[model samples]
Target chain A: MFGLIGRMRASPGKRDELVALLLDGTEAMPGCLSYVVARDPVDADTIWITEVWTDEQSHKASLDLPRVQATIAKARPIIAGFDSQTRTEPVGGVGL
Target chain B: MFGLIGRMRASPGKRDELVALLLDGTEAMPGCLSYVVARDPVDADTIWITEVWTDEQSHKASLDLPRVQATIAKARPIIAGFDSQTRTEPVGGVGL
Candidate 1:
């Protein structure tokens, strides 16, 4: 089980567009299981993402895709910091 | 893979408390894979939760646990609404 929770801060005026791109990117990812985008109710510039991947290898492979890389590049300037933690579920623990 | 994304609304002043309880609850869940809590930067009263489970059965079982049930009861009033979509990954999709 591979997962990551990323906290992103968007440029003051570009938050909504970032969210749209992320949602679109999620739909484009071949290995992505879940790609959720959320906004802070109070601070619209704050963004939250819940990402789920099939496994570490697949997740790693996803980084090489052209569209995925492009989307990331487009977001670099608008993003504050990619505060994320990557973790895994030990085999046999749950669905594994 | 089994996953659920639930949106919770906190009472005017109870948002923080709800986050604490939910975080604690995640630590206690037997089949939980990922338990995440996020706050809307602006609203203060808004909350977002990202939940992952081993499978649907484990998730169902979790709801039957005493502590889990109690937590739900304790949170019903403070919760504005639970807007969650339950979904699954077809077998052979990535890690499956």
Candidate 2:
């Protein structure tokens, strides 16, 4: 499976709004096995997204998905910067 | 829910071994909603563990579990160092 783990810094005081945008419309993602949005405990403005996809192609394809594109556009303003991004290969584990 | 995302660096050539140790016996962990072990695509010796638990107490209690403790003991030598560890509050997602 393919995985993408990323940390994003939201504009100050906009973390919750950013998170809401992320969680919205995720139910329709085709290749998504798991898509979790989490808040950084220490840094209130930081958010972490953990995604598991069936394959890399599916992940790449999702970017062109209208809902995803729209969400990205909506979130662009509140997104201060990406702190880290890691692509991963998930071998085996629960929830996969 | 409580979440913990961590990056661990394994001793050279021991990434697979460390990953096996982490995946072992996770089925029995109570209150664990999701537990995924992934390998960093760029770094052969780096692994990321993404976990979601029912609560912080459940996560803390899991450390003392016999299977978990044994795995920790076995993994200690091969685990070079932790690159990052972040505690999180998981609001909503597919896996959970």
- Best by the lDDT measure: 2
The ten-residue window of minimal lDDT in model 1 chain A covers: A87-96
| A54 Cα displacement, candidate 2 (Å) | 1.5
Tens-place lDDT per residue, model 1, A1-96, is 466655578887898788777665545566566555666555657765666665768778888888778888887888876655434321122222
The TM-score between candidate 2 and the true structure equals 0.92
Model 1 complex DockQ against the native: 0.08
Expressed as tens digits, the lDDT of each residue in B53-74 for candidate 2 is: 9999988999999999999999
- Name the runs in model 2 displaced over 4 angstroms: none
lDDT of 2 by residue, A20-89 (tens): 9999957677888889999998898999999999999988998999998999999999999999988888
| Candidate 2 DockQ vs. native | 0.78
Give the TM-score of chain A, superposed on the true chain A, for all candidates in the order listed.
Answer: 0.80, 0.96
Q: Per-residue lDDT for B47 in model 2? A: 95
